[model samples]
Target: VEEAKRAGAKVVVVLATQREADEGRVGRQIADELGVGVVYLHGIQFSGGDEYCEYIKYTLAALVAALEASSGAAGGNGLWPLLILALSIAVVAEAGLLARGWWRGGGRA
Candidate 1:
């Protein structure tokens, strides 16, 4: 888990059955221990398939809200500009890779 943090992964999700909810709570403990965040989906009975999907959707939405709130509070220069810069870099790199591949007779195979 610490290794994952070092590798730039911020969020952790723990999905557990109703009977295993207590054990799944350990994810929250681990997140607290690591001073990171955890989102847990518990009390999910495997028998109810569609309801489980709704529960998961709600949990994911809540997690996304928490992350966005945290990012807003810890704003350096805001995320939009940073995201744009990152996207631009990715586009340029991809284009360069395609160009190089085309030069090397690797085009549109």
Candidate 2:
């Protein structure tokens, strides 16, 4: 983190565990100490595996959008195509998972 500051990074994102969340509120403290913009995603204990996967996918999409926006002001068409592809893949994968679960007697529960 200190190295990042020295390297002139503008923002920081902290992904904290439950223990770290409790102990001194590490994420907020780090943000305050760094005096930079921070994004803290906390209270992750209640989330399930699928939720975590979805969260990761969403985060990746957001990062992709941000990177594409930062690259230039030409309004590049590249990102939209990539976004569409990613969404399609996610949708298909989710559908397949649902079908598999149903076939495995998941619907019984």
Candidate 3:
């Protein structure tokens, strides 16, 4: 993990299961020491091949989201802008709904 990170690789620690007698303490310890993203697959290790594929898909999505969030927190990026836009749209939609409800109630309440 350290070597990979030194070579400019974004490292993410993945644990196959947390059901060990040590309760995955070793994997968690390494991840903590390295300050890397750790994904615990839980019982998926005992699942079929299809579940493994699903795990890959979701893990990739999670990794992308984590990267985006970290980049957004690092500096002035489009993330905050996009978040504000989304919030503004939500507020507008909520206000429209409220106005319609109030109108239906004959301006009461």
Candidate 4:
């Protein structure tokens, strides 16, 4: 963990128990000692299968939240949504033109 930190890597610890996550004992110590983020499995077990899927979802969400909180990079500068809207409008217009041409017997023999 310390080596990773020294290498400029973001460290996050995932514990398997609620007490470690909520009580702020083991998790807190680890977080403070290594300056890392800590997330617990909460209601789900760490075993493989369906529980593993849930853990993956939870871990991804936690990671995204941590990144957003730390750097605000995920929020963007508000231009992406506008670009997406413009792309959607352009697609809709193209589709409309195709539909209109089809309706007017564009492929007539």
Q: What is the C-alpha lDDT of each candidate?
A: 0.58, 0.58, 0.55, 0.55
Model 3 CA deviation exceeding 4 Å by range: 9-11, 19-23, 42-56, 69-109
- TM-scores, all candidates, are 0.41, 0.47, 0.38, 0.39
Q: lDDT tens string, model 3, 1-105? A: 577557543334454555353546666666566665455543453456544434544544555555454453665655556555555665666677778889999
By summed lDDT, the worst window of 10 consecutive residues in model 3 runs over: 8-17
Tell me how many residue pairs clash in candidate 2. 0
User: In model 2, which regions exceed 4 Å deviation?
Assistant: 1-46, 49-53, 106-109
TM-score, structure 4 vs. true: 0.39
Error of 1 at 17 (Å): 4.2
Whole-model lDDT, model 2:
0.58
Candidate 1: count the clashes: 0
Give the TM-score ranking, best first: 2, 1, 4, 3
- Which model is ahead, 2 or 3, in terms of TM-score? 2
For the record, the alpha-carbon RMSD of candidate 2 to the native fold, in angstroms, is 6.1
Q: Of the candidates numbered 2 and 3, which has the greater lDDT value? A: 2
The per-candidate count of clashes, in order, stands at 0, 0, 0, 0
